[model samples]
Target: MRLVVCLKAVPASTEVAMDPVTHTIVRDGGDAVWNPYDTAALEVALRLKDEARAAGQEGWVGVVSMGIPATASLLEDALSRGADEALLLSDRAFAGSDTIATCYALTLGIGRLCAEPDLILCGKMAVDGDTAQIGPMLAAALRLPVVTGATTVERHGAAVDVEQVFDGARRRLCMHGPGVVTVDKDAATLRMPSIEGVLAARRTSVPVATAADLGADLDRCGLAGSPTQVVSCFVPERASDAVAIEGTPAEQAATLAYLMGEVLA
Candidate 1:
């Protein structure tokens, strides 16, 4: 069985600045890390792979990412965790991709990985955009069943059982293999890489594929394919005088209750 995990590299800092003209986060010259949600997805994928191995089955885990060539380092982290191989989709033509365009590029890359994949895992959302649209969009483009916001997953034969969280409620879902899953942060904690894992990752080669390599249609691969355009960006006006209410314990409790009621109401 082959499992593919899609990951995105996002800005590491919480205080991200927006481009005045583009209405998008200014990403250039910033520290980057794997999206936190994607880390959970990776952990789940690794656990699944380990289970398969322990059961005497041959399982392969692949880390697949779409970004600039420099972002290939992001795959190294996944490799150090447990993935068998890494595929990087990078090209100048893939620049300025919106969610739709991203899904298109990702579909093309995934197509090149293998004819069929037993499972595909992705983060519930990418921190840079926070739209949480690419995973479902990719599933739509590929015409595959998708389970989003999955917090837990288990495989039984060729089928998968997933526990999905939605609006504070958990729903159990069952689907056959060759499906897509977008995992939430509550799914699992990420595993730290051991020294041996790090050295192994450093020695492993990451194959890079471009638009030409993927044979992607030029009219539907990047900025040219994006239908949405940003108009402008500006910082929101901040409150001039932020007030703090402090008093005796009783007074503080009363104030907190009043605020909560007002907010809820």
Candidate 2:
């Protein structure tokens, strides 16, 4: 079995700055880390790899990402976490890609990694965009089945059983191999990298794939391929001052209860 985990490097801090012209986040000059949710997906992928190894089955795990060349550092992080191989898709042509365009590029890159992958894992949403669209879009491009918001996954024969949190409830589902899943934070916590793993990753070579290498069309990549355009971005104006209620603890509770009842009722 072969698993491909897709990850993104996003700004580590909540303080994000936008480009005045493009209205996009200024990613190049920020301190970044692997998307928090992607870490959970990586954990799930590593666990599956371990399970396969314990069963004496031949399994390969690869980490794939599309970002600037500087973001290649995240590949080492992924490798230290247990990915057998890493591929970085980087090129100037791939810059300014929207969700749709990004997914299109990723699909091509994934195809280059393996003719057909047994499983693909991704974070439920990227902290940068918060769109939660790329995973499903990639699935569509690959013509593969997808399970979203997955909290847990178990391999069963030729199928994969997944548990997801939906509308405040847990739902279980079973799907065949060659599928994609967008994982939630509750999926699993990423394991810390040991010194040996870190050294191993440092020694490993990470292959870089360009847009041309992926056989991507110029008109179907980056800003040209993006359908949606950002018109403008601005901070909302502040609202009025808050209303303070002064009273004893019990009186305050009573007042809060009354306000809640009045508002809800």
Candidate 3:
């Protein structure tokens, strides 16, 4: 069984910057980490790989991400945690992409990974984008069935069965062969890298794919292809409504106590 996991490198800090001109996240460089939800998907892929090995069948997991050159570091991290292969889709042409354009680039690169993957997994949504649109869109692009918000997956020969969570209820679904699943963080716990695996990651050479390599239509990529436009990005103003008691320290304390008593009463 072959599994393709779409990984994403998101800003580690909440203090993400925005580009003034392009209106895109200014990822010029700060520490980056693999999206935790995507890590959950990888965990599922690893478990499936182990199961296939136990059954004396071939299992391979390939991890791919789309971002700047720094994204390779995240892929290497995946390698240290047991991903069989890694690929990075990075190109100047892929900048300022909205969810639709982003999915298009991913479809191109994943297509290059394998003509037909047995199973495709993605994080339910990226922390940076938080749109949760890529998985379904990519599935549609490839003409494959997809299950979103999947909490559990069980492969049955050529078919895969999945359980999805919604409004505190779980629903089971079975999809035909060659499908996609968007996994939530609750799906599985991620494993840490082993010492030996960390050492081996240094020697792994990850391939980089350009827009041309993905056969991307220049018009349908980057800011040019993105339909959604950000009119402006700014920090929201914080407002609070409260009364200030002005007096000597003791008097203020007494007034605050009286107010608290009134509220409690």
The list of candidate 1 runs beyond 4 A from truth reads 15-26, 240-265
In model 3, the number of clashes is 0
Per-residue alpha-carbon lDDT of candidate 2 for residues 96-119, written as tens digits (9 for 90 to 100):
789988998898888888778899
The lDDT, on a scale of 0 to 1, for candidate 3 is 0.90
Task: Please give, for residues 119-218, the per-residue lDDT of candidate 3 as tens digits.
Answer: 9999999988789999999999999989999999888887888999988999999988899999998999889999988889989988999998888998
* lDDT ranking, high to low: 3, 2, 1
Cα lDDT of model 1 by residue, 184-248, tens digit: 98889999998888999999878999999988898887778888866665558987965477999
lDDT of each: 0.85, 0.87, 0.90
Q: Candidate 1: TM-score?
A: 0.87
- Name the regions of candidate 2 deviating beyond 4 angstroms: 235-240, 246-265
Ranking by TM-score: 2, 3, 1
In Å, residue 34's CA in model 3 sits off its true spot by: 1.0
Superposition TM-score, candidate 3 onto the true structure: 0.88
Worst 10-residue lDDT window for candidate 2 reads 21-30
Best by lDDT: 3
Most accurate candidate by TM-score: 2
